[model samples]
Target: MIRLGYPVVGVADLTVAAAFWTAALDLAESPEWARDSWRTLVRQTDGERVLGLMLSDSAPEQYPRIHLDLLVDTTAEQETEVERLIGLGAQRVDWDSYPPDPDFVVLADPDGNVFCVVDLSRAPSGS
Candidate 1:
């Protein structure tokens, strides 16, 4: 049976991207699969969920249709994590698509790849 693998992100510089993402996601580089142009980040507890960073010269998408959404338990946690990510080279995007009140905050990585930090506690039960 075919199963889903890790999500691969395009980056202009593997080292820089890997560094930022690994720290932001609290992941570690899998040395066994390490390469100059590619790197895999895995969670320490169980390496089931992984993120792959591949070197690319193309520019990042300003408005990517597909992006990662990081979930935090509480609004306070979400705010703290967003600030921490910014310190690690993430930029807060002045998103124009948000509703009057949004449960998620959009941020762009060092390479300008967009992602969101979400607080599900504030969302409706079925959302």
Candidate 2:
């Protein structure tokens, strides 16, 4: 099987993006990188993998089509997080759920990268 790695995000300012993710995901920033341009973050509950965010000197001209879908414990908290992100320049493109879906919300990051806030209540525990 091919190894699919965690996505590394490119941001204008890693510090700002880091703060947004920390507050939104309740993740702790890792001090592995010596420079502010590169930073690591891991969730407190599961430290299996880390998400990397790097500072980009030039912004992406095209809309970022790919994004991370965060499985959330609570939709309410996720909503709050979404609001916080929107406050920090993240855009609200859409919020949608089909009949089969339990719960979820869609949002775009500051750079137009679209992602989903998914409710994990339906997932098998311990996954």
* lDDT, candidate 1, 1-114, per-residue tens: 998887999999888898898889889888867888888899977975589998888998888988999999999999999999999999999899998788999999999999
Cα error, residue 80 of model 1, in Å, equals: 0.6
- Listed in order, each prediction's TM-score against the native is 0.93, 0.64
lDDT of 2 by residue, 40-123 (tens): 888788764567788887765343567688776776777776677688767776443444654666676665556677776655
Clash totals in order: 0, 0
Q: What lDDT does each candidate get?
A: 0.90, 0.70
Which stretches in model 2 have alpha-carbon errors above 4 Å? 1-4, 45-48, 57-65, 73-81, 84-89, 94-103, 120-127
The worst-scoring run of ten residues by lDDT in candidate 1 lies at 44-53
Extract clashing residue pairs from model 2. none
Clashing pairs in 1: none
